[model samples]
Target chain A: MYAFEYFAPKNLQEATKAFNSFNDSKWLAGGMTLIPSMKLRMNAPSALIDLSSIEQLKGISIKNNILSIGAMTIHADVANSLDVINSLPALASLASGIGDPQVRNRGTIGGSIANNDPAADYPSAILGLKSKIITSKKEIDAGNFFNGFFSTSLDTDELIVKINFQIPESAIYLKFANPVSRYAIVGIFLSKYHDEVRVAVTGAASCVFRVNELEEGLFHDFCSSVVDKTDYGITNLNDDIHANSEYRRYLIKVMIKKAISILQKK
Target chain B: MRISLTINGNPVSEDVDNRTLLADFIRNTLGLTGTHVGCDTSQCGCCVVHLNGEAIKSCTMLAVAANNSEITTIEGLSNSEDLSAMQESFRRNHALQCGYCTPGVIMSAVDLLKNNPKPTEEEVRDALEGNLCRCTGYHNIIKAILDVSKAG
Candidate 1:
């Protein structure tokens, strides 16, 4: 990688103090994406503030109808947490399906959400469940948190403290995983919260986006019957070496259908 | 940078460069070559190791950050006398051929069994998804992990 001074702070306050003192320093969370980018010479931060030591960033808890997870919580923690499994089993399943065993063990929820890769699985779960991104400064809604590909509304100095999701009556996540990276080729997260049915589609677009048409159809029927007749064209989907835009669009519908079917079965 | 941690049930202290990755530190500085490096991009789990008893890609972690944590490498799996149950299973089932990917696979399997002692075939496959083996495909590796779990 590039030349950089690494600081391992013992707590969040110290980490934030060190982070705010620097101009071009980056917080190192998991480093699944950042380390590779650095190895390729794409980014060379002058300093790195390692947040892995901050204990406040790792945990999961559920209170009332809200499921709260610390930002630095790893996929393995989420996958194994009884609290997560009891509150939002779909989220746990999504975490378990991310990358592989090693990645799940190292990759942090904060890192995944902050990077906001279009093919990432957490964005779909956030968008579908209408979660809130609680940062050091403000609590931003999931809709406003994501801006575009590898982009978010988070400021450079801001640190993601925790994530909160409303407990939906029923939810399911379905993704066609890439054979190599295990990233989602087309992931769909469907949730029924009270009277509204929300559908979030990732991996097939520039970013995880809400499918209003599918949501409306699902809200009306809440079954696979409406999905059979609905037509979701591959107009704005992403095309790459793994899959073309048309295939992603097809997978989106297929995954949504699968998610709804799974939800109905439960 | 001076980093201190417990490795293979022993306390270790080493002064490392700021840019040194955990995988490099383990293999080069400590001379624990059992942890291999496959794809430095974190896509492959050839450098998998147990950080505080949980399997993680050592390539993506900084050596300095691993201070005060408990790390277990493949060399630590077997005692001075006998092989670990997982290692015996790998040997019995011929889970490894070139053996480049053996360390990571075994580390992952160790973590998998620690969490779920009796994982199903599909669960074993899912657990080993991060580990890539061009040799022997993955059928034998999965079978080895399953056999070990069943016997252990």
Candidate 2:
């Protein structure tokens, strides 16, 4: 890592100030991805505005039928939160399955979505549950937040405060995780709110995306049979060493089936 | 930058580079060699340490970020007189071969047991995913953690 000025801001205002004043500054959330990238010399920022000290950006709460999670809340905390587990066990389970215990202990939900790694799990949850991303400036719907692979609609100075997820009637996340890195080979999150059905797939594309065919099939008839009948085309899917595009398309159907089966039993 | 923290119950202060990793600060600056750095890519858990009571990979964290926080390394697990229960269990179960990954494995296991006192074998295995052990094939290490849980 290159030598840089580090500032641990106690509040969002100070963080924003540091970010605006610095030449090439980056907001350090959990530093799980940023530090590693810096160490690898892939990213070299002039200043690091650490947000760990900002008390306002750390918590989990539920109000108005929305599950609000602070941006800086570590994955371990989200995984073990009683409120999250009770209100949305699928989200808790998703947090718990990210990486390992050590990774969960340090990685934050905000950092995960901010980085917007194509293989990350949070984007799938955000899109599938139709969460609202509450930033320092405005609340962006999860559908509109993600732009493309490793990209988001967030401005450089715009800090994500928290994310608000509406509790779905039934939702579940299933992923075919890479054994070594534990990133998803093809992860799918399926959620049903009354007659509305949403299917978000991650790790099998350049960005987290929704499968309209499966969503429409499930919307018409919410069952494993409906998902099994749908054919998810391999066009525009990610083809990597872990899995080819055709294999990813197949896994998407399998994962959606698994999630539907799990939701059906719930 | 100058930073201060409580390490192994001792209050210490040091000046380090802004990019200094916590593992390097612990092993090089502080001379606490018990915390090993097997792989610096953050995949290997050889540098696992307790930061504010949570087991995190020290290599992935900047030393300055840990300022004002409470850290517990492998050396803090035991005094000069005797070894910690988890360490003792590893010794009794022959869970170590070259001992390169033992300190981190023990540190991770101790944290797991702290959270879930009586974790099952599968649970222990799942928790140990971050900590890699090539020599023992993980059979004895899993048994050692289970033995410690059963003994408690």
Clash statistics: count for each candidate: 0, 0
lDDT of 1 by residue, B1-152 (tens): 88899999999999998888999999999999999999887867899999988899899888888989999999898768799999989999999999998999999899989988999999898888888899998999999999988887
* TM per candidate: 0.95, 0.98
lDDT of 2 by residue, B28-135 (tens): 999999999999988879999999999999999999999999999999998787999999999999999999999899999999999999998999999998999889
Instruction: TM-score chain B for all models.
Output: 0.97, 0.98
What is candidate 1's TM-score against the reference?
0.95
Q: Give candidate 2 misplaced runs (Cα > 4 Å).
A: A231-234
A1-266, model 1: which lDDT tens digit per residue? 88888888878788888887877899899888888888888999989998887888889988879999999999988988998898889899999899888778778999999999999999999999968999988999998999998999999989998999999998888889888887889898889987788998888888888987778888888888788787744477887899998888778777777888888889
Native contacts conserved, per model: 0.92, 0.87
Model 2: pairs clashing at backbone N, Cα or C within 3 Å: none
Reference-based lDDT, each prediction: 0.88, 0.93
lDDT of 2 by residue, A1-266 (tens): 78899999999888999999988999999988999999989999999999999999999999988999999999999999999999999899999999989999999999999999999999999999969999999999988999998999999999999999999887888989999999999898889998689999899999999888778878888888886677756479888889999898888877788888888788
The candidate scoring highest on DockQ is 2
